[model samples]
Target: MRATMAARGHGRRLAAALWLVVVAASAASARFVVEKNGVKVLSPRSLRGHHEASIDAKLATGCDPFGAASPFKSRSGRPVVLLVDRGGCYFALKTWNAQEAGAAAVLVADIVDEPLLTMDTPEEQTPDMAFLANITAPSALISKRFGDALRLAAADSSSSSSSSSEEVVIRLDWRESMPNPDSRVEYEFWTNSNDECGARCDEQQSFVSSFRGHAQLLEKSGFAAFTPHYITWFCPEEYLQTRQCEAQCINKGRYCAPDPEQEIGAGYDGKDVVLENLRQLCVHRVASARNVSWVWWDFVVDYRVRCSMKEEKYSRQCARDVVSSLGLPVEMVEECMGDPEADADNDVLRTEQIVQVGQGSRGDVTILPTLVINNVQYRGKLESTAVLKAICAGFKESTEPPVCLTQDLETDECLNNNGGCWRDDKTNITACKDTYRGRICECPVVDGVQYQGDGYMDCKAVGPGRCAVDNGGCWKGTRDGKTFSACAGSESLSGCSCPAGFKGDGLHCEDIDECGEKLACSCPSCSCKNTWGGYDCSCGSGLLYIKVEDTCVGKSTSAMGWLATALVLSCLVGSGIVGFAFYKYRLRRYMDSEVMAIMSQYMPLDSQTTENRPLREEAVQA
Candidate 1:
């Protein structure tokens, strides 16, 4: 049976992270403010403080005197927006206030007269309280109701010098230092404009929607900007030489001596700065705006440090400063989770306020009306809200990949996906992961983690396993659980067979040319030698024939019976003829001797003893 197994990880460093997520969040939004260039708000009248505002709440029709913990407590089953009496509350302060009000979150809004428009900075500055929402989007609706109630109370307390819980009225017209926060609502824009001014103005408007900061908002919405922070390495000029770079690795770089070259309109100009455009690219691309994450150095931090300076001493310092700057905030990291973590601070305005305008009971009365509309935080950088909005929109921010992927072990379309790993098409297993990929979703965590070349990146096993995308065509990886050997059809990473004569480099397949290698040889003269898949030798039939097919040719007489018979016939005929001729000669000699003996009349049988006296005449036959 196929089962769906989900693996979850909380704390992962993003590539040049632009944002983070908060836990236990109620909900969130992709709120943005795109209307203001630099709006400055003005109200004809002044409004009372929070103390007076709550008193006025009592007068509202729905006001519950001594409300049960929170007015919206019973509304938990539904999405509830915390409605604050005013905007300009920071996350820490607003978070606390929202809890106090029994609100999931708070939306602080201006009285329509004072809405800010632009920002040049982000973190913090002088105290011109910006209302960064610590609540949720429902707070916006609540703000409307809260504002309406305040107006009603204003009428009741307007004429009287007495301090009734009634609200004070501020009849006002408005001008924004930037753009109007309300314009975002009117325009139906999903995000702020791309420029700094637009981002700041939109941030101000967006802040009024919630004071939870980026983290909580993302958590609540179950949405995140998939933007990755881009961090680039600008090496020193000397690293260009491949050999030198291989040796020291500190000198390679595209940047000029003083400053690295930048892809943007402005080149590095002899100064090393974090690449802003690169960061934006990452935030917009890799990490995205939907599932926000942080940025880590991956495996390049050490290498990057070395590349930063010509001298080790200077490079070390530069690397240290850069990394420190790049590191995520402790509290932010803790939000996800980590070791030796401490409780997060709940202070309001932990960061300095970036903008300033007026001063009053709210601490910036002249700017109060705009504060309510622009949603400045009570504490923190004035444009932090805007920065957040920019982060979410993925226009001003982006995400960069820790590494690039190569095509090999997977099918052609596997890489088309943003994720480098492949999925099992048959099982519909997206997490199945490629065997040789750098990043795997299901790779072991902690105790079982396996990586390539140490622990820099996680690795996994995938199939129908083929070849590795690395130098070796062989995919039978064994190191780090990689094996470069396998059955015939099931070759390793390269998915390559030895090709009848080829070999492998452990990561991939290569050709093994026997002929080119001088492995082939002549017969008999050549002794045989074996190689990867073929054998070459000197075994030929020309030297001395060993009749393997016809075993009984010259060695067997029966097989040559015809010739042997002819030889016997010739010997018999010659012997018979010679005997006949000898017989004839003897007969003729006997006849001649008889004639001679007859004439001489002295031939006898006993002549043999007296050959000299008988004169052989008796043998002549008279």
Candidate 2:
């Protein structure tokens, strides 16, 4: 019996897959250009993954529309945009088939001349639709008239093989699809917290987790405003008393959601999803009131991880724990949510319903996991980078921030291991700088001192003010109320050296013994003792050591005084002796001269007789 039931379930799933093959159309306003006969023709079209502004590729016709007919082969070995008639398969299956045949993109032309409609993915997931997730190539839907023109151009080019210029080319342009009317972009994310809804749920959760950083950055910097919305339906009045309504709705069936398990007695009912959605809405509303609306991302991500449906932990208690952990006001969120059991309208949930309707250029958001930027729907893979690029494109030219202009989003490498850069644990200073491209390691200037070195490994403080920061990364110590630093009065620009009385590289210094090494106080009467950063010396009791001369002197140094006084007396005595000798010799000479003059008065003195003195003798003779 169990085997039979399982086989029945498989058969139902297969039937659902077949039923989904019928093409469904959505409203889109993007346009594409076709080049034929040396002229460009513009036509209205709707493109899926409307992210890029323009994509140019050669046209290839008569490819399998359902991908089961024949493989698509391109002649030029370049990117080919495969054209097919819209009928045999789902839009997603067509795109997937073209992708498998090595087509860069696909354009499905409508059989009738109706307005262009968006080619969307299947609403429900099935085993046959498993290739939906791998449909990365962009696709579009064109009118019947444009399709015929492209076919004729291709036919003409193929028949006349001599001229390659006759080949048809088309350009998918989405530049004007999303308008950039202002400097700031306002976007809305239509999502649900139901984790059991399969691919759509997973996509929503993944986008929230990966895009949280960028969203918060844009919000905090005032570059963008983001709003999250959840879709809810009101049960019909006829089914109000049914078991489905009771299990799937709250507030007397006013707001409801499809049962997650799609069964009455299965795991989680629709009411559970609705309540969680209300709680998330309340979280955002409360956070926005507090002027920190970005915390909504934190609460959602945390709740998804801690309280998942698969783990059977998706309960009120788990959500409360997540809310409290993020410091959000639980009482405020509760008050905003109001009584789920009350038979009245919830102001928060009611507002969400009113905002769900189409307004201005945007249409009603009927699709799950939809992104609307600048009041226009963004149809593409719900990935972070792709969504970011579309949001950036919504900004006016030259009004984009550095985050948008950069090649990639900011990785915040400094948050992890300081980006493998140099850091001072004591000062909490790091050389890593987070930028839009990634992280860079460069020495930083702190206080007035600039650091110099290879920032990845080392950053040594330099300049006169370097000592103020970690003692210039040098060795320092203090003892007995005395402190010494190897960086004190340093003259070199970088590197460390031991101070005067210390030994070792400046990184690690030890006191030196002046007396032991005979470097100081070398006199016999001197003694030395090692200190923390230097040495101390003392002389014997009766001696004093001269630091300048590095010599010992007697304390009772009267000997130096006596030697000075003796030298002064000896100079005086020698002067007196020389004076006396000179005076006596002069007196003797005077006496001899007086005797000679007395003798000469009586007669000419023999010693005075000379040729010049002969006149005196002659006068005497006359």
Candidate 3:
């Protein structure tokens, strides 16, 4: 027993010597410092102006060290901010959630939130570091307003009140170093005179560009989510004139005068301004990095310093200017962002390289699949849903909002057709997407009157001498007296079209029976035959069956039948008129008389259309 005691004594002495070495090493690595109120905190060099938030506490250890209790305030309607030792997994839900709940700071008390001391790092053999996520801290502010009411009453009278009440200041760091998809390394913040990301709430309350610099780091790092300081001034908004009293505003490590309006408890806060400033910083930073293709490019672009949008002087300039300065390419510019289609042929585009991403062709239905081009989405292995959403939202910049057939924007819900949403226009149940424009969400105009130097022809000009579409919009000349078909190529039919080879004006375009010319046969033994649109070239003049190019034959031996057919074709504009007009009538059967009346009422200025027989200006769309 005495030998065992000696062995234990030796081990204790050796462990004490090792403890001294660790303490000395830590003293060398870490220095003690104090930060009073209103110190300017700067973000890391790589991440500009990233500041760590702070929170006050009751006793450094709120919960019993050996027992258990919660840090959550049951009376608080605001979301819970778990004040454990180290800020970690339990409450770090996401930045979005934090911002939504209006959490100004985080406080991690002592290990009472746990029964034992939880170190910042985990032991190697431990399979799961479940304790790492909960917040842990040595000590914290004891008298701050938040902590004053939270102090738990303890019956242990031997514990000195001063000891429990004493405040402990700690450097601002993510109390717990946790790895998350949105951010890998937690930011540790400190303040110095030259910290560059914040701005004074002076005249314009202009924001310094550096704050955004840090946010861009988070974005580029591919963090799924994040939240920065939604800072609030701890001091009162009204200034204290006494020189002895500390200044309430924290500006660059010094307290300065803030506007009476900007004093704490001011109804109109700069929270939105803070949000916008971050967004602007993102824009400037991302733009600096060559070309930006991402769309989660979050920023504040809404109007400011304006009471109404209708006033000409009221500028949506804040939003418009920030967005415009990023210098987006024409194809990258959002369509509806106040700028309308300046050029008819102009198109919005997004490209990783040479592939044509979105080509809004005329009659191409709608761009409603307001996302990656329909086929492209399914084609490429998009990294995540984020990539898909970004491509789609970016592609949707300036796309038309859907207007239901009911003509109501609010009530119109997109209807699902076979695959895409159906357009509201009753006549054309074609697929419509957010990207569609014009009356029917028809594809952008790509052709037609555009070819004409003048803007476009009106409906009145849809007749004979007018610039009307002819022959299915393929050829455009008035017909005289010739039948046209696929047999007759899409060429103008005029002049006494002669039979093809002979080329005189008898039956315009008929193949002349040149085989009847005995000498033209070139060989008395050869035979040649003729057909419309072309004829067979051969040796014998009898009947050649070869499908040749130019074998024009003279009048056939069966001439009596041909003469009668020519008489009808000569009956002005050819006997083909009735058939062609009927086919066209199939397309224009009848107009909705009721709709015409409604349109007429709306267009009372259209003097040409009177009440009796409303002369509708039949505009022919090409």
By summed lDDT, which 10 consecutive residues of candidate 2 come out lowest?
Answer: 1-10
lDDT of 3 by residue, 1-622 (tens): 0000000011110000000000000011112111111111121122222222222211122222211232222121233332323333322222112222232223333322222121112222133423322322222221222221222211111133444332211132221111121213222111111111122121011121222333344446543222221222223335333321132322221222222244454332232232233333334334444434222233321222221222322223444554555464322223322122122211111111112122322011111111122121111111222222222222222232222122322222234332233332322323332321112122222224112111222111112322222321222222345433321222332212332354433322334466665424444344556544334555334443223432433335336547877776587555478778987776565555556676866665345436434334443331
The number of clashing residue pairs in model 2 is 0
Against the true structure, what is each candidate's TM-score?
0.21, 0.56, 0.19
TM-score (C-alpha, index-matched) for candidate 2: 0.56
- The TM-score ranking, best first, is 2, 1, 3
lDDT (tens digit, per residue) of candidate 1 on 60-92: 111112234533332113323233333343333
Query: Against the unseen true structure, what C-alpha lDDT does each candidate score?
Result: 0.30, 0.70, 0.27
Candidate 2 per-residue lDDT over residues 1-622, each given as its tens digit: 0000000011110000000011112333433222111112321122112111111111112223334444444344435666567776677766676677556666566688775554556667788767665666766565677555555544444556564433333454333355676789999999999999887788788889999999999999999999999999998989989999999999989999999989997999999999999999999999999999999999999999999999999999999999999999889988889998888998888998988887544567777877888877776777888788778777775467678756464346788999999999988888887643346798999997898879899988887878888988889888899887888544766677888888888989988877678888777777777666666777888877778777777867846867989999999999999999999999999999999878888876556566557797789999
The TM-score leader among the candidates is 2
By TM-score, is 1 or 2 better?
2
